[model samples]
Target: MIHNKKEFNLGIALLVLFFIVLFAMFQPLFDGHNAMAYLDNLYNSISKGSAHYVDALKEEAKTLAGYNVKVTMNMEDEAQAADSVALITAAGGTASAQGKALTINGDYVAILNACLNDADKLYNNDSAALKAKYPALAGKDDRQAVYNWYKILGGFDKELKKQEAFAQAKVAFNVNSKVVETAYNYYKVVPEQIKNKIGIVIFSLVFYVIYTMWYGFAILFVFEGWGLKISGH
Candidate 1:
C-alpha cells in the first residue's frame, strides 16, 4: 500500500530513466569506445603528457660530465651481466663481466646520456631506432633492452650511494624512476593536454558524482512513499 501515490510514481519514473541511461553508457557511442573506456583513456593520456622528464634529465646529466665513476653491481644472472657489458660498452664506457658481477668504469655523463637516449626513443614509440642502434637487442623485444637499462641504472644508483657519490647517485635515481620507468610504463600512449579535453573532463567528473547520489535519492523516495519508516514502539 503506497502511502503517497504521486511520490512513488515519480520514484518509479526516475529509476526507469536511470536504467535506460545506464544501458546507453555501455554501448560504443564515444568514437567506437564505451563511455568508461573513453574516460579511462582520457585520464591516462593526460597523465602521460605531464610525466615526461627525459629532456630535463638530459640537461641535469650535463652537470656530471667528466665525472668519472666506478661501481660494480651484481646482476641476476650471467646473461644479464653479459647484456650489461654490451650496453655499457656501447655507451662508451668500459665494462666487464665476471660471472654475475658486472663492473662499470667511465665518465658518468656518457653512461647517463646513453640511458636518456634509450628512454626518449621508447617514450616516442621508436623501438625500431632503439633496436637498430643496439644490434645486440636484435631478434628480441626492444622493451627488454630498456628493462636491462633500468636494472643496470638501478644498480649504479645503489653502488654510488654506498660510496657517497651522492650527486651521481641522484642523477641515476631520477633516470631510472622518472625517465626510464615512466617511458616503459606509458609506452605507446599518446599524451594529451587536459586543457584540450576540459569540457568532457569536467562533465564526466561531475556526472559521476551526481549520478550515484541521484540513484540514492530515488530509492529513498520510493521507500518513503511506500510507508517504510523507523518508528518507536
Candidate 2:
C-alpha cells in the first residue's frame, strides 16, 4: 500500500514539474492581469499599429532635415518675411526645388506611394547621404538612421486594424499610427508580468504536493512503529 502511495505521489510530482516547466516557457504571454490584456498587447505589436507611427514620424522628420528644410520653425513674424525670402532663395516657391523635392507624406498612403515610386532615388539610410551632402555628419557614424519609413507606415496601419478588431482600445483613434502604438507598448508589460505569476504558481503547487506526500509517509512510519511496540507488549 505504501509502495502504491509512493508511486502515485511520484507521478503527481513529475506531472506537476512538467506543467511548471511548460508554464515557465510560456510565462511571458500570460504575465498580465488577464488574457484580454495579453491579446491587446500582442495584437498591437504584431500588427505594428502602436509603435510604427512614432518610428515613421521620426523618419519623416529626418528625411525632411536631409532636404535642408530648417527643422526649427520661427514662431515670430519678425523673421517671417526674411525667412520666406530665404526659403525662396534656398528652396524656391511652389515650383521651387524645395517644394518638388521636399515631399511631406503624413498619411501612410502617401508615404508608401513615395517609397514605391522613388525606391531607387531614396537612400535606405538618410544620415549617410545627408552627411555626404551637408558635411555635418561626415565624421559621425549615423548608422542608426533607417530609411524604412514607408514599411513602418504600412505596418502601423495593419497593426492598428488588428488592435481595433481586438477592441483593446476604448475607440479607434484616427490619430497618427505612432500615438496608438505608443499606448500599446506602454501596456504590453502587463501580460509579461502575468506569465511570470503563472510560472510561480505552478512551481509552488508542485512543491506543496511533494511536501504533503513526504509528511504522509512519515506519519505511516510512526504508526507502524507504535503497532510493533504494542504487539511486543
lDDT of 1 by residue, 55-159 (tens): 799999999878998999998888888877877888899999999999999878998988888888898889998888778778887686788889888898899
TM-score of structure candidate 1 = 0.91
Clashes of each: 0, 16
Model 2 per-residue lDDT tens digits across residues 144-197: 111222223333344545544322111112222334333322432322333434
- List the candidates' TM-scores in order: 0.91, 0.21
**TM-score, predicted candidate 2 vs. hidden true structure:** 0.21
Which run of 10 residues does model 1 get worst, by summed lDDT? 136-145
Backbone clashes counted, model 1: 0
Error of 1 at 49 (Å): 0.8
lDDT of each: 0.88, 0.36
Q: How many steric overlaps does candidate 2 have?
A: 16
